[model samples]
Target: MFVEVGPDDFSQQALYDRLCETDRASQSGAVVTFTGRVRDYNAQGHIEGIELEYYPGMTEAALQQLLKQAQQRFALTNAGIVHRVGRLANHAQIVWVGTCAAHRNDAFNAASYLMDMLKQSVPIWKKEWANGEAEWVAAKTTDSQAAMRWLQETDEPGA
Candidate 1:
């Protein structure tokens, strides 16, 4: 597992390469990766950029815990996540999550789970600058609904 929360920019390819190296024993047959980017347009319209904020220590801890859960539930051999904190321009990459597993299903599901969970429970906040106005973003109902499926899954026996 590798997790990073910081201001510095990252190379998506570099991180993917690192995740590929995570499985040293040739145990992983599939790898899946995801990168989230700040959109130029959002619900409010004409978004120029976003300011990401997070409580550094607390945010990192929460992210790590989420990753651990994904690893265990998906039987992933390895995973990596990096979340950016600070100002980001339109089209800037905001987050990266990757997983390595022996099967395609496990890697794909783990990556999907990581992104879904991070969207809801993580302490990070987004302040969007759009139409020359800046506002703190409100949590979306869809995001909450998406994350809820995992909770329901965990409630099922041996799930």
Candidate 2:
């Protein structure tokens, strides 16, 4: 498992290459990845950019925990995450989550779960700049619902 919380930009290809080079990568039959990018628009209006901030040590710990949970909940050979902090222009990558498993289902599910939980579980904060004004982004109910859905699904016997 690899988890990084920083302000530096990362190459998606580099991350993929690293994931594929793991010692147990050969055992993986499927690799799933999710890349989140800042959009030029949102529900409010035109978004020029965003500034992300997080409690350094705490943020890393929370991310590591999420990765560990995903690993335990899924049959994953390896998993990784790279989340950026600080100002980012529209269309810039914000986060990347990748999972490798022996089957497509596991890899896909693990990647999805990580993203859903990451939105709510992490301590990162976002200040959105739109319409020439900066405003702190509030947590959306949909994000909470999505995270809760995963928790509920995992409790079901067949889910």
Candidate 3:
């Protein structure tokens, strides 16, 4: 498992290749990855960019805990997550989450879990630019609703 929070931009392909190399490619049968990007606009109208803020050690610790939970729940063979900080322009990649497991279901589910947990637990805050004004982005109830779905799944069989 690996967790990183920094200002550098990273590519999904590079991460996957590294994973495959670190863990023999023959062992894991599935690999799942998710990438999130900064959009050009938000409800505030045209967005020039977004600035993400986080507490140094706290942010990395939270992400590491999330990865550990995912590994325990899904029995993932390998997992990695990288989140960008500082200012990012519209269309710039913001985050990447990846997982590899012996089965496809585990890989997919673990990746999804990491992303959701990042949304819920990470201390990072995003400020978007609108009409040359900066506005802090608010958390949406819909995200909590989505999180509830995962909670429900954990109660079901084979979760």
Candidate 4:
């Protein structure tokens, strides 16, 4: 498992290439990826840009823990996550998760789990800037619900 958090521009192609390389090394047959982008509007209506803040060391550790958990919960060969911070415009990539596994189901589930963990556990904050005002964005209940589903008794416990 690999996890990175930085302010560099997000690149889907680069992430895909890295995941493919990992798959080749592990002889995995399937890869799954998910990318999240900033939308033009939030629940508050219009938004121009977003500024993301995170606790450097803690954020990276939390992300690595999520990846490790995903790998243990699913039959994954490799997992990678990259999340961008700083100022970002609408439509820009915000985050990405990639997973490789021997089967499609494992890859899909791992990718989904990575996203769910990121949304719920990662200590990153976002502030929206629009109309010359900036405000902190609240965490969504839907994201918490999604993360809780993976923690149910029926779900496999992660490392």
Candidate 5:
């Protein structure tokens, strides 16, 4: 498992390739990946960009724990997540999650679980830039609902 939180942008293809190179890749039959990008607009208006902030060490530790949980819950062979911080323009990649497992279902479920949990539990904050002003983005109820769905489901592979 790998977890990274940083200001540097990442190449999704490179990360996917690395996931395929994991020690147990030959034993895994499926690999799932998710990429989140900054949208050009939000409910407020047209967006210029977004700035994400997080407490460095604390944020990474939280992400690492999340990865470990995902590994255990899904019986994943490999998993990795990368989240970008600082100012990012519209359409720039914001986050990437990859998971590999012996079954396609496990990989797909693990990827979704990681992204949903990250949005709801991580300590990252985002400030949206729009109409010549910036505002701190608030957590959406939809995000909380998404995360709750996983908790409510008892069909997890390793549960």
Candidate 6:
């Protein structure tokens, strides 16, 4: 499994190809991919763009820990995560997660777990540039709730 955090132009096709190659190499029967994009509007209202910031080594270490947790909890053959930083325009891809497993259930669950953990546990922060002003965006309650669900599950079926 690999987790990468850096500046990327965000290409879906390129990511898809890489996932396919990894899946093939790992001899997995299923692969699940997810992409998160910057929305044009936030909960407050309209947004022009967003700037993401992270504390370099800490952010990568946090993601690696999440990946380790996923590996322990799921029957995955391989997994990969890539997150972009710096200023990003509206509707640009911000994150991508790929999971490969011997079955669909594992792949699906791992992908969900990765996203949930990333949103909840990662230290990365976002600043919204909207209406000619910029402000730090608070973490969403819904995301925290989603992440909590995993902790509540005593034994994830596919884990």
Leading candidate by TM-score: 5
How far is 54's C-alpha from truth in model 6 (Å)?
A: 0.3
Clashing pairs in 1: none
Off by over 4 Å in 2: 23-26, 155-159
Off by over 4 Å in 1: 154-159
**Which candidate gets the maximum lDDT versus the true structure?**
5
* Candidate 2 TM-score over all chains jointly: 0.94
Ordered from best to worst lDDT, the candidate numbers read: 5, 2, 1, 4, 6, 3
Deviation from truth (RMSD, Å), model 4: 2.0
Q: What's model 3's overall lDDT?
A: 0.86
CA-lDDT, candidates in order: 0.87, 0.90, 0.86, 0.87, 0.92, 0.87
Q: Residue-wise lDDT of candidate 5 within 69-135, one digit each (tens)?
A: 9988999899999999999999999999999988899899999999999999899999999887889
Residue 152 of model 1, lDDT score = 80
lDDT of 5: 0.92
Which whole-number lDDT from 0 to 100 does residue 1 have in model 4? 70
User: If both were scored by TM-score, which would come out higher, candidate 4 or candidate 6?
Assistant: 4
TM-score of each: 0.93, 0.94, 0.93, 0.94, 0.95, 0.93
lDDT, residue 3, model 2:
92
Off by over 4 Å in 6: 156-159
Better model by TM-score: candidate 2 vs candidate 3? 2
TM-score of 5: 0.95
What global local distance difference test value does model 4 have?
0.87
lDDT of 2 by residue, 63-155 (tens): 999988888888678999999999999999999999998888889989999999999999999999987788999999999999999988745
